[model samples]
Target: MHSVDKWIEIAKECKYLPENDLKRLCDMVCELLLEESNVQPVSTPVTVCGDIHGQFYDLMELFRTGGQMPDTNYIFMGDFVDRGYYSLETFTLLLTLKAKWPDKIVLLRGNHESRQITQIYGFYDECQTKYGNANAWRYCCKVFDLLTVAAIIDECILCVHGGLSPDLKTIDQIRTIERAQEIPHKGAFCDILYSNPEEVDTWAEFPGEDGFWGAPKVVFQFVHINGLKLICRAHQLVHEGFKYMFDEKLVTIWSAPNYCYRCGNIATVIDFKDADNREAKLFKAVPDNERVIPSRTTTPYFL
Candidate 1:
């Protein structure tokens, strides 16, 4: 709770998705990144986050479960809006931290950052109700532009919202993406933002559909990829709120507990404290009644 009050005060005035313009998000984010990109990267302690679908209170649970900020820089792997309730509350909290301590928080971009996705989920509507559609659209673009696609900490670990696509041969290529589109089209860029878990239970490779062609191959190719010990992401929903996919090389962190429509599963995260002590801990933050094994209706809400 470092300056939680001041943070909230700033959040009160923070923008929402409805107020944003989808076309200009990345430019704004790049500009902001340039301002603090000079901040020395540190491994003092880092929390690798998954996806948070508007569960702001659950984010508080994460802050309580993993530990607080300033002491440990937070890396949010996107989806700060849509689904659940309180998109504004959730984005405001994270935005406030970014505004207050730019050096301590690294927020990555997720597929849901786009206006198209938010419209289907809850954020777009929430914004209209709270800030009106016009404001929501404007804030949406600004927030999207502010998101980071990937973050390299001391060049040891690489993190993003989605896993590697088959065509992506290296990490450097990920950095060069202009990342300025309002939304991704079907291509290399779309593949990056829209990738899913590489599991038969979750995804079937579309041999020719091509989008999922190179995904499942990421783990086997890990040794060839340089400067990456692990790839962390959060896109697909986990029954437990977080699923460690791709034979552990890729980890999915869902910071949103009891995800969309209250499925009643708990979310989790990974913390790297030192070289040999990188740990994955799962905690149930959802209430017991809802935390039961989700029924067959437990489909991923990403659609």
Candidate 2:
């Protein structure tokens, strides 16, 4: 069986929807799959990245820090365009890279990818704010919809833009993201958007109220649930550019240096491959103590 077939089989087993529904859903997802096929065709020895929030210069630094693209298959966990000054340039550069090395880049959808979020957090708003928003909206939205929900490499590591959610009953649950849903609501879509890693979720009451869901058990559950070693995700600024959670069941990486209105903390990513037998480690693009920007802003991301 081919890789895609194996993915579908696993997704079918862990399906929340019935088989008939699964087929229908997959039929819709089929087009997305085809488009993605030409988008990032390679997937080994991949370097997984975290959030890149429109800091165009920093992103260039990141590529330097992380090393050249496609040489090591690239997986960007999400948050490619937002919160900084150069979303247009950043997104265009990434898209160009994707087009050139269609076989090497893995792009995941983040909270910012949704239309609503983009209207607020994407380059659309930034363009409007910075460039008067004339014709940017049309092209930016087109690129936004093309982003994928998640990417799994070698069935050993899973990657997503945000934290895990209670709605995810199994690993295959994420591996099989429908990727065909409309945005701007707090449904399964919101869960993906708001998902965050927190210890409280592990020992929380049923129907947890944090709204988004995640826990160490879920990591193990999903790992055992899917037979993968580690899940790598990007979202949540790690002062150190990356963080390890759930006894290392999940690793949170941030490729955006000086996240969230330029706090000045750098970023990091991990490179893994079959040659090294799927081993993973954290690589930093910048450092934490370096956040000495000499000014402070009251703007908050969590709120």
Candidate 3:
């Protein structure tokens, strides 16, 4: 393993790491993530963050407001790449921190982490552009496959990138899911990663794809079966940066402030303390300063 200082240096500058270093970092992190179950168990007094979406500056702003790794245990509900300008930098920093403090950081898989999604969104192109090749992108996808699907905080709050799955009624069912593969088109895995609670009933179905019913019923069964009190997720955008639905039985926390640099929405993170208290901290997108802006031309990636 490379020195922690080397990774920290790369993170500080948001520099494009060499291909070898990137591969090594991904390999190390993959080993750690592979050992974790689909329903990763975590303790309290940890801050739960939502979708990052490559908003590296906002992520830095998050650390500024919430504190850095090891100092504060963090559960990142994922979407660490795509849409924003610094997918490479944003994800690499989180991976480095996870590698450094494996027990301090919990990185879950978001819908955008998959190969098909990244290629359509921004991460794949960002990796290719940053390294002048696809090796870095490939390495990162391997790590993505290893990322956990969800986390149970204090055995009460279930943190997932998306909401409940019809096929999965219990935490043990979720554990039976075979991860480490590309996100499927349909089924419990894809549903948890892509389905939304609000749109479930009204969702249009394509061939071979199942229809999602509604948030309330699904969430109730999931929580009841797992013996959990709440479910936290982050696939939808909320104007206030967070939204409580189904009588606060489910919460959606979105950390990508001003999504796509145009949504004009706020971002938030929820801190869960040991005393069984949950506090939601709201923050805004970072100012359009030169330091935080991407140096390379980012037009092609979006196209």
Candidate 4:
């Protein structure tokens, strides 16, 4: 087995790992993820981040802002791949860190982690372009299948890629989901990964999407019934980096700053000092002069 530390250095430099080494890294991460629960429990002093959509440089900036792994525990809520220029390097770096320090890093599945979504978005093509085949992508998808769906920080704050599910009222119900396959079309599993927060009176269908919009009343009820103090999620892009709804009962943290490299929006992460006391650390996109931009290609969202 290759040293994860060395792989981390290569990934940070925007270099692709050899296909065999990448496969080994994926297998190592899969073993670690399989031991995690569907709703993993995390301790305090952990930083909660939102979508990372393959902004590799920005992710490096995030580590600088939030502090590095092992020393600073982190729980990434998902959307690790797609939409950016370095999905391969980005995902591989996270996988390497997880393999090296499983206790310090927590990766949760996002709506975009699915095979169908990646194929539609950008990860699939990026993999093809980088490695000249889909083998690396397949290996990464296997790791995605093993990722936990949600995480509970100190057993009080619920962290998920999307909002709550109508079919599942409690966190325990979320734990019962069999999440080792491709995301489903419509069900609790799909809802947990695709839903968004809204101002409706109750659970309402999200127009033009496969998920639902969780109403404030419904969200408050869910948190109260489950004895949760807060729900942190990321799916929508908030120009200010993060947004709180339902009187702070739920929060949306967007970590992909200057989204798509043109949205001109900032990014933020939640630094949980202890579970109750937390601070929002905001950051901007890495300056162009500081990093090398890869050759341009047509991204799905732009096309």
The residue-by-residue lDDT of candidate 1 on 92-161, one tens digit each, is 6676566556778888778778877777776766666676554644555566754667776656566767
Task: Show where candidate 3 strays beyond 4 Å.
Answer: 199-213, 295-297, 300-303
The model with the greater TM-score, 1 or 3, is: 3
Q: Which residue pairs of candidate 3 clash?
A: none
User: Any runs in candidate 1 off by more than 4 Å, and if so which?
Assistant: 1-31, 34-44, 199-210, 213-216, 286-303
Superior candidate under lDDT, 2 versus 3: 3
Q: Between the candidate structures 1 and 2, which one is better when assessed by lDDT?
A: 1
lDDT of 3 by residue, 1-60 (tens): 457668867786777677898888899999899889999989988999999888888898
**Predicted candidate 2: what Cα RMSD to the true structure?**
11.4
lDDT of 2 by residue, 65-98 (tens): 6677656678887787766655655665665555
Best by lDDT: 4
What is the Cα-based lDDT of residue 70 in candidate 4?
82
Best by TM-score: 4
Q: What is the lDDT of candidate 4?
A: 0.91
RMSD of each predicted structure: 6.1, 11.4, 2.5, 1.3
Per-prediction TM-score, please? 0.78, 0.74, 0.93, 0.97
